[model samples]
Target: MAEKEPPGTTVVIHGGNYGPSSQQVVCPNCHNRVYTVVKAEVSRRTHIIVILLCVFLCWPCALIPYCIDSCKNKNHYCPSCGSYLGTYYN
Candidate 1:
């Protein structure tokens, strides 16, 4: 069963699997239909991978994780109101 949120609390529930791309969604803040704008950010996991690659493998290859979208987190925002919606973790 799916989890539920507490009463009087606002939550941004995603319809499907979100990715590093723009998608159509209903803005909870603005109460309007709009497309989401995605921004890629380096996460802790990416930092760990970079460190491991540099220590175990090579320093040059350590940058690979930073260049890959799957190694980062995608932050979703409502274009209409610019409210933070959610984050897509890889």
Candidate 2:
């Protein structure tokens, strides 16, 4: 089920989407700057395993995880208030 937001709350979603670039983005919830990159849909351990596979198993095979949105979606979160902005799907 999808989670619902409370009434009268606004979250600004910018077309300000990008890849894994080192940049600061506007935080809708905090109304200030925040680190844009958040975790992928995959868990931390899963990401580590993927990284290990990319290093050990095969080079090109690493694209499998990198191409998957569940593993690559860049979630944007507010640094000040700890809120979500949006997900950047590559």
Candidate 3:
């Protein structure tokens, strides 16, 4: 069993650093009603590799990755706290 914290204790909890994007979401970190800091749908690891393929293999081949699903993901985060809420696949 752990000891209880004193009455006047200040605990600072912080979140992670997600990409730059403005979105509205409830911040679990600060417990704010809602935070607007949605990030843009960023590319995935596979997408980068495929993009390289487009450059190396063929320039036009780059479009191939865009046409396919799972090539990118939409990341949602809290604007106020920057906590990762979830990811939406497009």
Candidate 4:
């Protein structure tokens, strides 16, 4: 069964399977097969890396740089291939 979030409450999805469940496709920018989350621990580690990078860079610039893009959608998609890049949370 799927999980649920309460109304007017914030929740964090620790890890889950996402993206196209088929052969990997190349990223337009990097031209690399996107990595899949085979293990929840691995995904958590990657999430930490991204958050740390954003905090290090954006925190110096401003407190909420990621929020600019996140306000629209949770995950940002590529206009060219329509691939799920990642979520934008600030």
lDDT for position 34 in model 4: 48
Better of 1 and 4 by TM-score: 1
User: Pairing residues by index, what is the TM-score of model 4?
Assistant: 0.22
Winner on TM-score (2 vs 4): 2
Error (Å) of candidate 2 at residue 66 is: 9.2
TM-score, cand. 3: 0.44
Worst 10 residues of 2 by lDDT: 15-24
In candidate 1, which residue ranges exceed 4 Å CA deviation?
Answer: 1-17
Alpha-carbon local distance difference test for all models = 0.83, 0.63, 0.58, 0.41
Clashing pairs in 1: none
lDDT of 4 at 3: 65
- The digit string of per-residue lDDT tens for model 2 on 1-90 reads 978889965444476555554346666566785556566665464577578887796766765775565565576666678777666665
Error of 2 at 75 (Å): 0.8
lDDT of 2 at 5: 83
Model 3: per-residue Cα lDDT at residue 35: 43
Candidate 4 CA-lDDT value: 0.41
lDDT of 2 at 51: 82
The TM-score values for the models, in the order shown, are 0.75, 0.44, 0.44, 0.22
In the range 1-90, model 4's lDDT, one tens digit per residue, is 986867865332223323322223345455555442221122343445557767778545343333333223244344445655554333
The better candidate by lDDT, 2 or 4, is 2
